[model samples]
Target: MNRNKLILLTAVLLLLAGGGWFLHDSGFFQAVRSLEALRAYIAGFAPYSHLLFFLVQFLSVVFAPIPSNIVAAAGGVLFGTLPGFLITFTAVASASLVTFSLARVLGREFAGRIVSKKLSEKYQGVLRTKAPVFLTLAFLFPFFPDDILCILAGLTSLSFRSFALIVLLARPWGLLFASALGGSTLGLSPWVMVPIALVGLALFLLGMKYGNQVEETVLRRLKERRSGDTE
Candidate 1:
């Protein structure tokens, strides 16, 4: 049993290592060696490349710090509203799922190293909650680092079925928010970008803090109730 667990763990590590190497080999890493260069390169593609753009954005989300919002906006600018929206949404979902599962198979310790200390700790209470709705809230919040959170959430007690349902529920708003970023670039008011960005971020923080707190409180109360009944 121990040997099996070790083999599984090794396989997971090798998978992540493979992704890292693939990104490096594909020039995904080298392109972003300079953020300005990456921006210039992506911006230049705004006129004629949709599929390539989507691939870059997807890989960036999975492998680097090239933020999702930028990719979404670029999608809109490149593909023009509808197509960009659809393509960017699909890429984000795919990238998110890939990263989430990678993190899940990799385990909490590996996840913590890659993600933030604060983020991983907060996810623990949710893990203990063991409710589908709790996961939905976790995914719904934009501030939660959706991809990383999904990976961490997998480390929890939630089943694969629950995890997937929460992801589906969370998709529309996230997709819309990102698509808006990309699609918004086409319109007259790039300045309108400010409020949209703020609102999305605000909801993310609000939901993560409040939702997690409420979940923790409910768990505490339930434990008390159970203990009281025992006494």
Candidate 2:
């Protein structure tokens, strides 16, 4: 590993250790018993709570297995809409860039360890087309395997700038929507929340069913456009 990556890895390790200490014997479950409880806990940290929230969001993406929506929702309850969305967006976007960079710098060998051979093979053809549009769409949707895609992106010909730009542009809406719901102080009746929940569920299922096809078709169109221009 290069000096920069080595330093980054060390920093990540230290952060993980610190987080472990925080969670150790702490009433993490009790905190989750209610939104108010969680909010109060975060507030107790005062001015630094935002920074702590930022770290959790960052770690969520870096760890990949951690579900970010829960933390993001908590941000909304704790900080309200605009601030919560901004915090989640910044953390997720920065984490995406970091994960992508790690994969790119570490090369295919490291990426292979992160992503399975079967999953890589499945998406291999789509990625080979080298379309940024598809990547942006992938990141935008909740059902897509975004973390896996980030690792896969590092193995592609895409530049870091383009990747970062796509991440920034595509990642916010879903998170924003979730955070907004959580932050809304207006006690929404089940009638309202249920329909909203249903819509989100429908969108998620649709993304799962059609996301690959949509990505492939977009890539094919882009490839055709490039070939025509060259011709």
Cα lDDT of candidate 1 equals 0.62
Tens-place lDDT per residue, model 1, 1-231, is 256656876776677677667656756555555434544556665565676667766665545465565566555655566776677667766766766665566666556656778866755654555446555654555434555666676676666666666666676565566666656666747578788767767876886668667656754665566567569
Taken over the whole model, the C-alpha lDDT of each candidate is 0.62, 0.74
- C-alpha-based local distance difference test score of model 2: 0.74
Candidate 2's C-alpha runs over 4 A off are 1-47, 186-195, 201-231
lDDT of 2 by residue, 1-231 (tens): 778767865675577567655644354446645656666766777789999789767866755655677677788877887899899989988888887887787676567656789878866666656548768777776656777788788888889999888887888887898788767644577888778768767876887798778766765676777677669
TM-score of 1: 0.62
Report the Cα lDDT for residue 152, model 2. Answer: 86
Worst 10 residues of 2 by lDDT: 23-32
* lDDT score, candidate 2, position 141: 63
